[model samples]
Target: MANFISNAFMIPNDLIDKGYMKKMKGSALPCYVLIVRNTRGWNKTTDSMSISQFVEQTGYNKDTVLKGLNTLEELGVIAKKSSKNRASEYTLTDSIIAVDFLDSEKLDSEILDSENGSGSEKLDSKMGSGVENLDKLLSKNSTHNNNIKTNTKTKGNFSEEFEIFWNAYPTCKRKSDKSGTFKTFEKYTRVISLEKLIAILNAFKMDSQWIKNDGEYIPAPSAWLNKKHWENDFWLKAAGLVEQQPQSAETPEYANPQRRHIPTMPKRFKGMNA
Candidate 1:
């Protein structure tokens, strides 16, 4: 199970969607592609896994495995051995696309077994929406960079999913407290970098809320903070971070009374005390 999980689960669906697994979807082509990809890295040398062997290992029918292998070969995602006895050895055509194979499946909870509730696909879809937008704001690029590293990856070389789940800050556990100020802050901690956290905090004169507390700072209750977006924007700007203009007139980032803004520091006289 360790080898199976390691070999099968480690691959990203993003790589597959990026055309890595474009070979063929007939039969168990996807399964075979996954098997071959898991077994070999970019330096594709002559590697072979037979139909019978693949079926035995995966518990799929022999015909299904054969169909998948042939489909993969047809798509040019892999090259087969010239000789039949070698059990149809395959080679990767493109590593980048193949890398995305890990991202191919959406991982919807309904599709997975219920025991552990590895509903990662749902979690990713939810978090990714925010991360993707944030990346657009930061990078100013929208071409869809295939290898965009999340905040989790910047910290280490661990598997992306592990980093996302274990290393990254927790996001789901606190969503129930929508009125909580730390909601976004909590979400950001998981994906935001130490540098970005520092910058944003220094800009606001507030401390970054980390998953673990070293006794230096504590998260204030949500009530202590203002609900204005412009004010936050002002703080962000003070920290040298750019704020995007809110898209709708109804957004709270504006300065109008209808829309909340960050409070400005009051003016004062130098020698007013009696």
Candidate 2:
């Protein structure tokens, strides 16, 4: 009892002594092992083995497994028997071992049912283990994919907030780098609240420098966020009306001084008088 191998199916020593493993190498070896597992593994003389079952056990195509089964029968290593609607039944023969060595039993068809035809619960035990493991693996992957989607959704929500800043600020040119701008917006919001930033931006909309030249002096959206020039009393530093507006058609003041105007000093020098 102590010497019996735990969790092992029995194969007779003559199988090795006769070199069936090397002889049956590629296709037949796995087929033989699988039959041995379901039969002698459960103290039974025979098992009902299906071609699809053979494909699963050996990882070979249907034709390959059928050919191997034929070769195994020719070698007298196993005998096959089948009924009209049942899976094929196989028994190890004298050439390998179990035929002459093991006790033969007249097992009933089934108390429930079985592919081994041994009338025991052994077959489901093996199949249930495989199904249980597959279910567990699928569950873990589902949870992992859900976690990735959640983080992506959160990042998308942050970008939606940036659109507010993008729309209110007008520029001379179309927005070319909105992704880069949103990244800078994220960084900027850490320094100042969105409410405060929006207030400053709204004030700039009416500033003399921004109004004049049709916002030509205003930086593009990406540059504006990176330069952070909108900070530190930007609203208080609006340029007052100028007398020397540019004499260009694009400048509204060229058509009418009351429309808009700009001084000789740039926006940086505003309110810094000597």
- Highest-scoring model, TM-score: 2
Clashes of each: 19, 0
The TM-score values for the models, in the order shown, are: 0.28, 0.34
Deviation in Å, model 2, residue 3 alpha carbon: 5.9
Query: Candidate 2, residues 1-274: lDDT per residue as tens digits?
Result: 5665434565667677767777775678889888876665544557765565576557798888988888889888899998764567898764454322222232223433555566456544544554565445434434222123455544333342465466556656646666677888888777865545555565666678778987877776777667665554544243211134456757665456674465576556558567
List clashing residue pairs in candidate 2.
none
Off by over 4 Å in 2: 1-3, 98-274
Q: Candidate 2, 195: how far from true, in Å?
A: 69
lDDT of each: 0.44, 0.61
Q: What is the C-alpha RMSD of each candidate to the true structure, in Å?
A: 24.8, 28.1
